[model samples]
Target: MTELHIRAATPEDLDTVLAFWKVAAEGTSISDDSGGVERLVARDPEALILAERGGELAGTVIAGFDGWRCHLYRLAVHPDHRRQGIASALLAAAEERFVRLGGRRADAMVLTRNETAHQAWGAAGYGPEEQWRRWVKPLTDQVCSAARPDCSG
Candidate 1:
């Protein structure tokens, strides 16, 4: 395995970052979106760290922190770059960043079917929340309008 230098992603690296997600064979909900990549870079480059092996993008992980808890998502290592410790390194960096910002804990939402991701998260000190499960539902414009009222949220 080559030395993977983890660093903040830049606009120039968006293509490679999105490309990695594009070629992922299976096991994630990340889409190949150019607009989304640029939006992330505009918000916080550190949240979208890129792993490079001798200047080539090998892996990426999007770590978002909301002042209290850190959320890790979109962790994707190129198929060719799997098993090289890149994902682990990226995770370590994310935790460090979260702790530095006074975060209490880190969280990640992996697909229930992705055993590989489950193992990686477990090895990184994340355990399955048998007592709790984070649930989310996408809201469309119609749903959003239906839920809105003159004095209610």
Candidate 2:
């Protein structure tokens, strides 16, 4: 087992990270594109953390702290790199970042059907807040506005 190195991602890593998500991540996100990720890196460079082993991207976690709350997203470990403590390492790093940022509690967005992810997140001491439900509304994009009459702006 090679030593794993964890570091914040840079602009040069945006394309590779996007491609890696397609292969390693469980699901897609609205902000998965190059532009969205580039904006994230531009806004907060240390939010996207990457784990590398032997020069290959083994895992990634987005540890975002927005003043008031800490959010974890896109925790993906490559299939070939599973069971190698990469996820744990990534979570530890994320937690440390949150603590540094004065965050009280950290929350993660895990898909309902991803049982494997459930197990991994549970193992990391994060449990689902079943009492609360998530509600989301996508801000209108140009195509959406053109297609839907209700889409304002």
Candidate 3:
């Protein structure tokens, strides 16, 4: 087993990270692109964390802190690397970042249907808030709008 190196992602790692998510991550996000990830790394350099082993990307987690809250996303580990503590290592680093940023609590957006993730998060001391539901409204016209029908401006 190769030693896992956990560290912040660099600009050069953008394409590799995006590609890694396509294979390892359970689902895709609207912002799962080069431009979006580039902006994220540009604005918040430390937000995207990566776990590499023997020069290959093994896992990733986005530990985003916005003033008062620590919001985690994109916790993914390669299929070949499951149960090897890659996810755990990324999370430990994320939690440490949150605490250092004066954050009181940390929250992760996990897909409800991903039972495997639920178990892993539970083991990491996180619990679901069953009463809360996510409500979202896209800010840009690129998002499909039923009422307008033509979102392409």
Candidates' lDDT values, in order?
A: 0.74, 0.90, 0.89
TM-score of 2: 0.92
lDDT of 2 at 54: 99
In model 2, the worst 10-residue window by lDDT is 144-153
lDDT of model 3 at residue 105?
97
Estimate the lDDT of model 1.
Answer: 0.74
Window of ten residues with lowest summed lDDT in model 1: 144-153
lDDT per residue as tens, model 3, 1-153? 889999999999999999998899876676778988999999999999999999999999999999989999999999999999999999999999999999889999988878999998999999999999887677754464566442222
Candidate 1 lDDT, 4-107, residue by residue in tens: 79888889888877667767523434233677678878877778887889878888888888676788887878888888888899998888888888888888
Candidate 2, 35-81: lDDT as tens digits: 88999999999999999999999999999999999999999999999
Off by over 4 Å in 1: 25-32, 140-153
Task: Give the TM-score (vs. native) of candidate 1.
Answer: 0.82
Between which residue pairs do clashes occur in model 2?
none
